[model samples]
Target: MSEAPSASPHTPLPAAVPPLTAPSVPPHASSALLASLAPLLHEWLPRQRWFAGKGRPVDRFTLVSATELMPLTGSPGLLHLLVRAHQPQTAPPSGSRGAPPPADCYQLLLGVRRSLPTSLASSLIGQVQDGPLSGHSVYEAMEDPRLATLLLERLRVPGPLGSLRFEKEPKADVQTGLAPRVLGLEQSNSSLVYGDTFILKIFRRLHPGANPDLELPLALAQEGCARVPEPVAWFEGANPDDPYEPYTLGLLQPFLREAQDGWQLALRHLADGRDFTDEAHALGRATAEVHTALAAALPTLSLGRPQTELLADQMTDRLDTAVQAVPALLPYAPGLRRAFDALRRLSSAGPAVSAQRVHGDLHLGQALRNGDGEWSVIDFEGEPAKSITERRRPQPVVRDVAGMLRSFDYAARTNQPWNPEWAQRCRAAYCEGYAAVSGTDPRTMPELLRAYETDKAVYEVLYEARHRPDWLAVPMAAVQRLATT
Candidate 1:
């Protein structure tokens, strides 16, 4: 372990270069063992999609808890951990406020083996030397079938791992000894399919309270909503911050083996030059059905003029931030502000609007089309950037409506000849279908819907700028349209 060498001013440095030694490790762990693994973790973490510290160096790891699941028995040993990762802090921008807060807590599962098979080489985290685990190759356990199966087995039978508790919902029957296959497309969490009958989603970043992903769906299931997959079993662990409330770690639900994601389905229709209006209409009805069920099951509120003004202010603030991050939005900022202004004025002129929990982040990708051609909404995690508190707050249902409209526009614009007319048809048809089932037409609230759409487009602009520079044009075009029309 040595200090990182200073780079020359003329040379471009990589965003993150791990220090020779780990900044910190589990307090109670064998110092030598953790010391040996620290360097490996520093290098392995940033490469993972679920790691929050992308483009930032991992300064240290503070262990919340660590438990050996199953020690080596001719195969790899299993270890489960909840660790807080601290990234290197940078000074705030000029004229900004206090320093950025420290990092997030993440779940880690490690497989310790003497040597990895050639097939498992890609999963290697690093090797250990001169420690309790010396001469072992430690890799992510989720990648190893044996370890993954063991995790499923733990959930199949109600059990406890140290402070962590695994429990099944009443009436849930999870089959044991099912084969596990890792899902590769997940970004923020790891999911495994068990025999194509059930899927277990392991939440990587641990949140203090109950995650809405599980809470909402479990409620929906109890309300007899068939549009969402119900949680069959879940796992949680003791939270030091709130001893009364445990941190949700993972959820198991029935797998929709015959379902196709709506994004792909929309793309298929676009590729065939076929109208997606019918499917869009059906999806709208499904969305309305879910909204009704949620309203019936959860607390609903009314956003009075003052609250509406505050909401508009928040939208304007978000626009200001997006404009700052994506300078291309500068030209449209004024027009977008006007939309929010209109919303504020309109709200003051009318009675308070009903507010309830809607899908915080809704898009085509969040919907799935079953083999029966019915649409099912999935992933109630909300916007990843929003805090758990903000996401769980009640909001106007039109927010979800606006999100879906924007997604339809995205589908149209992603193709050549950018068919706004097609998007218009689908959007109108969707609203019509929704109105038929819900008895309230989203299109009737023109000003509010416009404002939400503008907000969503601004959010998309910033997102595309940061993650997919090539896709930046898509949202930018919508921003221009919103600003002018």
Candidate 2:
């Protein structure tokens, strides 16, 4: 698992191109084609891993936008769509049946063919019942090699497709015609690899802003940081009504072919029962390098007594919400607040804390190690649940340090024959490595680190309770340790 993270203060905002005004329907798209596909989408969407609303029945479908980039007369069709799926109302009163239920917008890349290729049978959504595509089989485009090739071709030659605009980085040399393969790992977004040269991440959830994933890494590359992959090409959508807010759809970057996942590497070291301090130290130094570069590239904020208090309030609020959802966290709520309370007092009496752009959701899984024994950081989208505004908010660098420290604990606890000392040694070594480069130790501010670590554990408790009930004990044990120790 590798993460992608964003932009500097001096980076110019993406210039707005005057909107492409034309007929509502793209030349190749038809209203009847969409009408036939709506029902099929309702049935197919809930089954896909990228679909957010699982375990809920779809009530209806609404078309937000649809562009037929390549039409099928005798060949297969390619459609790019943004559609809303309304969930069935479970708690609404009888009188409110007329009101529409809550809905979520999702992006779909569809490939329509008259006959199913045995290779693409598994990716089939369903056969269209009526209208223009009545006899065709529709499948996710990422699974069809031909459609995947089309996407890469578009990136290779940047141009517009209706409202969408594809642009290539000025200095990036994009080599196309490579075979595409979809990454099978479970993630918030879907990713496709084009041979060994490039990886394109297709965002499922759409937010109206410059995505930090694209913005941050491009900025770091500009800052001459080799610890991140170089961004090559990307696509964004602009609405004529609001040209200021562009929605980033996908990003293209150089693929690290020989890189090993940091999470798997840690597990291997633990399985072999070997010391990981050296690797941990290098990772810490890499983290520090990125942090230092980001501070210089982006605007830094100083958190005084008032802002610190607000931060404490947010921690307390998260704990309260977690208690309601997990119930098991209720007992540790008061003890956890002690950490935040200590932070409040420390910030009030002590000097102000420095805040800057950081990897908000840092963990071992978000890093990679190459054969040359160098570490690279990725995925700067922050917490997936947070809004774009929240993810972009500057915070103390200690938050990321705490996240990495907690991950070390996770590696020790989840692996058989738990050894606390292993994590302890690695944490100390990581902080030492960071301090050597940063000139300041993260452990100096014990209260802030403790508070952030506790907050992270609380979030894990809630996440495990909902997603992995059996693994819930990992965070529960951590909560007990943080509370008692």
Candidate 3:
């Protein structure tokens, strides 16, 4: 992966603050509390959808930082934490066992109370066994209105609080004390909508640099792009050691309260025996506009022969690894190889292809439609499986087109009577709309499109096999079609 992506002026970097994880926040007390919560977290962390260490036992935990946002003696108290979970590596590099396994740091906002509330029973993380919070009940803070509102207050007034820094846009008007409620749909993160005016997404997994979810949107907002919701405010950790790096822990944006989830909308259209050509075409246009803004705001590069060869190598490598994971992909190996290999053959004859910041991991689910039928892309957080460095790397816009194309196929096959023709129409219309906006037809670069599409199917094969064995056939069908076609 390339070196970590830096934030542009649009993303105003917070000044370095003294490290709050140590020499402050009472390290000994926090450590003792963490030790007592270890077993409870070990039981709770793996069960969370946002927990990355799924299927692996959490060997132990180390409290990276802890701050009492509100004293536990209050009616509702808040504890902000950056905790690292150490889990056994499935396949550590040779000789790595001598050292402890790599740990993933997670941002946890916990609500503590003396007595358990019946209403918040679902958010419970169990009672503490020892330390200052020994008998206090702790639960997810995002679900509690008092704690969630307090979070917004932290964002409204921008400044350093210990190592944490809260920031808002140049003239952002952050309304205070809106009743807060967490959205239940998010998988990798938790979000709370305050009075239908603002939504704050609390990142579960902590990263050391600016997350694209906030990075790209902030840039787009500065560029006056309405196709995506503008990020209003966010909070992060400011470490003197990593002075320039902003460890983003959350994002705050205007809540699109009336907007419908793009995936659910598509499914509804399909169930009604309708095609999504019009919606898909509009969505393609929206995606193109976003790409245009990103390219202008961020850096863009041309993929010449060397980069093209590297792209082919990565696709081929993934295919090879995936084939091992799911033998079903073995038969289509040669066909998939042909798709990637053609990239090398095309690289020699054509002018260099354009590569720019793109919506990594784009799919129907990441889009939202307002009541006016306008499309707005959300969640620029790229692929969760990839490192932030890799996710922010520039890539061909066709990667996004391929993702949406694959999503259309998924919608078709999932329906009882597989509607291949409907998916085809939507795919074609989408490409046409994209061309209308960007004046570049993705189909012009046939090999690149096929390679990305083929790579996506290979990924799906492994994902479905591992997570949803019965649904494995859906992606396998795409693999066969993409391979033989």
Candidate 4:
């Protein structure tokens, strides 16, 4: 309700002493309410695009933390939460002691009211039959402009809203009360565009420690990389119960209104049977620039025999897993292993390469081409299927190149006639441009590049089989080529 203290630094609050008001956290009317919403959430969460643990059944819902942004006593109330979803252990990740860890913690923003309008029907979670507000209705808060605008204001002020911490960049001059609307994009996260000024990405799946999306962009911006948008403000879960634990919930950045989506642009070119060599070359140069900046800003390692062999082993393991899930990949498994074996052979020959923080999941969809024909990469969050720690790991630059190459193939296949020649041309041009800028050609390291591409294709096979069955043939086509040649 008041401006932040003048004495407070513009930088993010340290893990130590933090200044703020007493937030309306659990002591308020929310615990009973959370208990009431558990059943509703279990039903609704699985249907959403962003929910990570899809096929797994939710065992229970644990209220990790709750913050009443706007109490239900007011107009339309806003409740912020970090709830952990417990699910059956399938093939769980490493590092587990006594019991299995929680499936995932989600950052949910819900709008509470006594009635839901016809327009907000799509946003509905369900009417709460029991809670603090016994007869109240609830829906996604971000879909409501009033609640979304209120969120921006909280970030603008930069202070404590209970266990939730809203922070603004020191140099960022954020405006108050900008009109907000949801950005309609197929992503694992929800985004709100505020009057073409900024876009706020609310992470539906919450994780401890800094998210790579926020961390990588900040690192690149510091390196004076113009290929990524600078983060303006962000909010995190400031757990009063455990102040030491960190959780990045959302990120806000300046919106690029005039930039054309790279995926859409590629699809349009494919549909028209146009040559995309020039654009592909320029995009490759842009990718090189981002990679260069990331190397300059962060840590880099010399990956030798040990690393390469380990990488090859990892690829083989992933391929085995994929074959188990998608039986169509069974026949190609032996052929795919050749790529990994080649990488191992190269490693045995004493070929060493550089490893650094990469784009992790670079594709046509993750890039944007401005009106001036300049390329800007977006979403540094890495692969959606990976954990935060995995996303933060350094990998070979060719891994990113491999992803974009796969994307070119996807674009060509998605178009009616499946133009492999166009994809081949674009791939070559992209590598040429990259070599020109980075002083290293990924094509020169054919074995390593092929290994990464095969690894990615294997991942795609499993993902498509689980998520989009109709798109199974797309990656299977690539599998056929990679398996044989």
Instruction: Give Cα-based local distance difference scores for all models.
Output: 0.83, 0.82, 0.83, 0.85
- 1-485: candidate 4 lDDT, tens digit per residue: 22222111122322322234536555555568678998789899888889988789998887877777776675467888888888888755455367665468888999887777666778989988876767777899988776787777777878877777889889899886467889986558999998789999998887677889999999999999999999999988864455676788889999999999999999999888799999999999999999999999999988889888998998998898788778999899899999999999998785587899998999999999999999999999887667888898889999999999999999999999889999999999999999999999999989989999999999988989988999999999999999999
In candidate 4, which residue pairs clash? none
**lDDT tens string, model 1, 1-485?**
22232222223223232222212224555455566777888888888898876878888877776666665433467777787888877666567786576478889889988777765778889887656787788888887776777677667767666667888886888876577778888888899898899999999987778888998998899899999999999888788778877888999999999999998888888888899999989999999999999999999999998999998998998898888888889988999899999989978798788899888988899999997889989889887656678889999899999999999999998988788888998999889889988999998898989999999999899889999999998988889999998
Steric collisions counted per model: 0, 11, 0, 0
- To one decimal, what is the Cα RMSD in angstroms of model 3 from the true structure? 7.7
- What's model 1's lDDT at 345? 97
Q: lDDT, candidate 4, residue 17?
A: 27
lDDT of 2 by residue, 80-196 (tens): 887678786456533454655336667788887887667777888999999878888888888877677777767776877777788898778877557788888856788899888
**lDDT of prediction 4:** 0.85
Model 4 regions more than 4 Å off: 1-22, 27-30, 91-99, 239-245
* Residue ranges of candidate 2 with Cα displaced over 4 Å: 1-31, 88-103, 239-241
TM-score of each prediction: 0.91, 0.90, 0.92, 0.92
lDDT of 3 by residue, 229-248 (tens): 88888888754347787678
The better-scoring model by TM-score among 1 and 2 is 1
lDDT of 4 at 214: 93
Model 3 clashes, total count: 0
